[model samples]
Target: MTTSSSYPDIDAQADLMVYLVLSQLLMRHLTGRWLTVQHVVESTHLWLLTNGGSVDWLQRISLGSRAQELAEEVAQIEGITFDVRTLEAAFSGYQHLNHRSPAVAAIYGACVAFVVERRTAGSRTGSEK
Candidate 1:
């Protein structure tokens, strides 16, 4: 289903986006094929450990069929241009500076940056400036 506005809904689905991107990244590191539960789990753990985030969040999550379903949906959202590798790099570096993994926050930040910049660029008046 399409969302109210691509921007806000993309923000809402940020978590799934990150996980999906992580899935792709992990796939590249692993077998370079389809993602499985093991791939998701390993990716999640690796991201947490290397990014210096607590592993406690894993307790509340399950990298099962449902996650794969959500990931597919989020990854297919129209008009969203995400470079999974670029996001991976940015997310990795962001953690070093902030002392925490950006996690879904990275997705939200990118959306915000895009919307703000787009609005400013397309504005007819200097009010947006």
Candidate 2:
């Protein structure tokens, strides 16, 4: 898919949607408290550790599949072709980041920073072409 000012590609859009889904799920589980991205990531890390590190199990218990379906619909409404696998991979990768670092919040924060940097660089390059 074409990159836009808002998203670098469909995969990035899907990743954002998956993040939103997880954030919403965490918010509901915490009784509607406000949450930052770090809070969601850390909570998800703890939850995965407690629940056998199975993304499929999380999906089953938390309506994650349904949320992905909804995200796909939203993408279609926006005229972008959506792949369910992109969301699935993003969700799994987000959870997997916890495994890469002992400092729970740090890894997620770094990952977000890296992605933002890459996207910003890409956009600048594209605009200069």
Candidate 3:
């Protein structure tokens, strides 16, 4: 099992997992192995936590419309977060990393957004309570 020795922080692990999940989703989708998308997401989450990242580090991700709904519905079964949205917004953040593949850049951007949102929400809940 690979560890997060290179990325000791929760944020860093989350970021890496985001890229991993997204990239794997796209790659699997291209091969028509769509079912594995969810598996990849779940595996990535487990890998992160087991490798030294926090449980709260899992970021948001999405497939297509129906796929998104299925993910959300199944999430009720396990209380997981399966966010669905377009990659357009996330892709913009990685405009600087032209050398990387578009999918890779998009995942990186999305991870940053997800982590920021999670932190913001956590802060808000703390302030409210």
Candidate 4:
């Protein structure tokens, strides 16, 4: 009989699971005004530590494509339109930040920047009355 521990990619799978949970929590928090970038980063770090993982492990693993897919799924479930490429870019940017900041903060910053840019562009186009 084969045991679950025998799986070669078990750690990766567990990390992905944790990412999914984090994504859900983030989505819920995004709807409220009290969720700051600092909160997101701190919460993410705490979650990782409690889940038997670390920021180093998260930074080392590449989950860009999977993250994009998960974002799409969450967006659909929440009835929101999300640009998967923007999310992909956020993850890409986080990877290149070189430990300067937490992944959640980097991604949240990118997302906020995107939203602000979109609002600015919309105003310029007179899309918002």
Candidate 1 lDDT, 44-93, residue by residue in tens: 66555554443234221422334454444444555544355443543545
Residues 7-62, candidate 3: write the lDDT tens digits.
23445544554444443444443454453556556655545554444443323242
Q: What is the total number of backbone clashes in candidate 4?
A: 0
- Pairs in clash, predicted candidate 3: none
What TM-score does structure 3 among the candidates reach? Answer: 0.40
- Candidate 2 residues lying further than 4 Å off, grouped into runs, are 1-7, 37-129
Q: Which regions of candidate 1 deviate over 4 angstroms?
A: 1-21, 25-33, 53-65, 82-129
RMSD for all candidates, in order, please: 12.4, 14.3, 11.8, 17.6
Q: Give the TM-score of candidate 2.
A: 0.26
Give candidate 4's whole-model lDDT: 0.40
In candidate 2, how many clashes are counted?
A: 0
| Residue 102 in model 4: lDDT | 44
lDDT of 2 by residue, 66-103 (tens): 34334333343332222333333334454432332222
Best by lDDT: 1
**Tens digit of lDDT per residue, candidate 4, span 12-63?**
3334333442344345545533334454455455445545453244432333
Model 1, residue 80: distance off in Å is: 2.1
